[model samples]
Target: MREFLIFSRTARTGGKINPKNLFQEGRLDIIRDFIVEAFFTANKKRSAIVHCFLYGQPNPPLHLTITSSAPVSIDRVKTATLLSDLISKKKKIRGCEMKKESIIEFLTKASKTKTIYLLDKKGKSIHETKILPNAIFCFADHLGFPRKEFKRISTISAETISLGKQTYFAYQALMLLQYFLDEKGID
Candidate 1:
């Protein structure tokens, strides 16, 4: 299984937010791309799970999980719209999980079997890191992780990995990771 856990430091936590205000809430612009890449990569042979951590509201920290097996809408606009609705409802769409939850809650459960890696520019090259079974790659949103969260992640034994020397957008990093997997024959 392949999982992409995205921590959005500026996304609204509750489901009552206005859908049209996602940009105002934060740059949710790349969110769909991240979701799409997670589902389509690795020759479409692996199961994908995208856990979006929204932490931009008063409630703070909403966990939205999207699984690849769920019946996805083909239209990009429809897909995004549906996701926005799900966020507004604070409810699951299809089989995805959309609810209020803490970052630690999700991480604790995910780290049990999956080898978690934190994406960082100062870390070792991702190519050098061994891809263990049931890998879970984590990345923060546009604002990136807070200082305290990064420290907590390190304590959890989540290795910090980088995509070469250059810093790329989160979606680009995901695509690069998929390409690397293809090159390394890791699938």
Candidate 2:
């Protein structure tokens, strides 16, 4: 996932904007020119991830999982709830917290190395959270080692195509995602 500059057009199965129609009607070409001009103007790189989303759907192929409508506290609650749901669905998690000794034992049994990424919302270290020292000591004492391979990232950028404005913001967000997940030595 090298850095990219994606030029995406929405899918057109129904009432959504169709890439074929846009290209045939010459709007996509105009957009392509605009994007190229903007990229040159900003002296930015050309790596991008062009995507098409279906309209009127709860889930898109590529989606922005974060929302601004919820308050901060509610957002955190929602995040925790979603993660809890995932763990429950997997049937692998026993309780709210997996014991650190169990986690270390599992890691020790695995033949292949695993990369555990500890990401906080806004790319802060979970260690940077309150009770950091206590939490670190607890885990260190349990595992006899630290899981510190996780990297911290700041923000994501993206652009949306709407209201006659090119979705440059969504593009930037995609770039940021690529930067975070691509070729950072996960193995």
Candidate 3:
């Protein structure tokens, strides 16, 4: 199964943030489209795991993992509600809270079997990169990864990938990646 790990630097972890205002808040704005498209792009089952680092919080970041083929809601507003319930309460809302983990912890745990790829223009062309059967894709928010976060990710030896020379928006990049994967019969 294809898994997408998105890192939102400004997304709020309060679970109270309005989904409709996700774009206005400059937090989940760019990722909203990606989350919506990632699941629907493929006929096969796919998964999207968003790791949100709130603007200054002592607690852990919010991790939302949703299966594309599952019978759960995936709309923006419904997704917002699910996120709110997932982060605010311990109980699962319509099977939302299956896992709550940190990025570091998740990276270490998933590193064994899954090949992690970081999206960056300076990396190799995705068309030529040999993709593994079990792969996890990572992307930073529009604001981009800060120096510290980038350094940490670098230590993981995550291969950098680029769609082309031009820089595209987060959602556009996702679509391009999916399209490339589909062309390679990887989706």
Candidate 4:
């Protein structure tokens, strides 16, 4: 399955955006559509959609976002380190309490210049590709036909798998936020 990752941002003047309410009852479909349109316009690629869920307080932190791309190698190490470090700081995701401001500050610094790597199960590189700010592309269909039997085209087969798009997109958005916060500092 083709995959992609997206990073989302709250509108500049607004408070934090909560992904949990994205499709609740009203509103966010509009917001999501706008973002999708903007994404396509910016990247010029056909990408599946994913949603994000942000968490925290006094401006909830970004908890999760739907994503489509494979996880970056750097992310695995960073996430593990962050969780462990939080333990030393006496902050916890499940049991203990964490200072929202401090956690945000930490994330902002830890998430910049992260790299994206896609590899096979055997751990071979797929493309060594990295996503620049905003990139997009669409799939292309077959271009040629058989010489003698046009019916042979009907025998051609395609396989499809459902790759949870919203979840992937959300994850990507958070990762991007992670990178951005790490670089620019949160408001």
Candidate 5:
């Protein structure tokens, strides 16, 4: 299955989410948008999973795993609501599962089984690279990952790939990546 791990530098760890103030509250709106893009199409959901690594106030290193296989409807509002319930309850809520896990830890473990690709503008073009099955694309939120985290990730053996020179939002990158994968019949 296609997997995406998004690192949100300013997304809240765990707490009540104000749907109207999602942008102000650690840019949860971006996370919601990413989830919507990852799982939803015009008429149905895609077979994919999203891992959100939230490092913001109240708590740090909150991991929210959203799977399309779960029996729940997904949309921008529903995604935010699910995040709110998962954060407050700190447990599995329908399609979402919440936990406290660091990005490094998750990558280190995933690298053993899945092909990890780091999405960066400066990296090699995605067209040149061979994307294997069960590929896990790693990317950052609007604020982007810190330099120190890059150093930590560099040691994990993940190949960096670029969509193009033009910068795109995380959700846009995900959509483009999915399209490319679909065209190539990777998934």
Candidate 6:
């Protein structure tokens, strides 16, 4: 299955989220949008999974794993509600699982099986790279990955790839990447 790992430097690790104030509460709105993009298409859902690593105040390194296998329908509101419940209750809900894993730990295990690609502006063009069917695209929030962490990520053998010269939001990048894969019939 297609997988995505989003590193959010400012997303909250716990506590209830103010749906209306997602931007103030560590930009949870972006995380919500990412989940929506990962599963929804025009009228159907895609077969994919998205892992969100939140490193924000009060707590750090909160991992949210959202899979397309969720029984309930997903949207911006539902996604935000699910997140709030997951954070406040600290329990697994349907297709979404919560954990306290770091990015390094997650990548170390994922790299062993799935082809890992780090999305960066300075990397090689994605068009030239051979993306595997079980590829996992790794990216960061608007602030980007931490310098020390980025260095560590490179050492994990993740192939760096560039969507283009221009920068795109994490959700936008996922959409483009999904389209490209669909065109190539990768999954």
Q: What's model 2's lDDT at 86? A: 25
Candidate RMSDs in order: 2.5, 19.7, 3.0, 19.3, 1.5, 1.4
Find the candidate with the highest lDDT and give its number.
Answer: 6
TM-score of 2: 0.21
Per-candidate local distance difference test: 0.73, 0.24, 0.65, 0.28, 0.84, 0.84
In candidate 6, stretches whose alpha carbon ends up further than 4 angstroms from where it belongs are 71-74
Candidate 5 wrong stretches, greater than 4 Å: 71-74
Cα error of candidate 4 at position 140, Å: 34
Better TM-score candidate (3, 5): 5
Best-to-worst lDDT order? 6, 5, 1, 3, 4, 2
- Candidate 1: clashing pairs of residues: 15-88
Candidate achieving higher lDDT, 4 or 5: 5
lDDT of 4 at 177: 35
Better by lDDT, candidate 6 or 3: 6
Error of 4 at 54 (Å): 3.5
> What is the Cα-based TM-score of model 3?
0.81
**Model 2 residue 170 distance off true place after TM-score fit, in angstroms:** 2.1
Candidate 5 pairs with clashing backbones: none
Question: Backbone clashes per model, in order?
Answer: 1, 18, 0, 31, 0, 0
Q: How much lDDT does candidate 5 score?
A: 0.84
Per-residue lDDT tens digits of candidate 6, residues 68-137?
Answer: 8764356577778777777777466888788889999999998898888899999889999988777888
lDDT of 1 by residue, 1-187 (tens): 6678888887765545444545664655566667777776433434678888877766677788888766544444555666677677754568677777787777777789778888889988876888776777888776788999888876664688888888788888888987887688764
Name the better of 3 and 6 by TM-score.
6
Q: Best-fitting candidate, measured by TM-score? A: 6
Candidate 2 residue-wise lDDT, 91-112, digit = tens:
3322222221222233233213
TM-score attained by model 4: 0.22
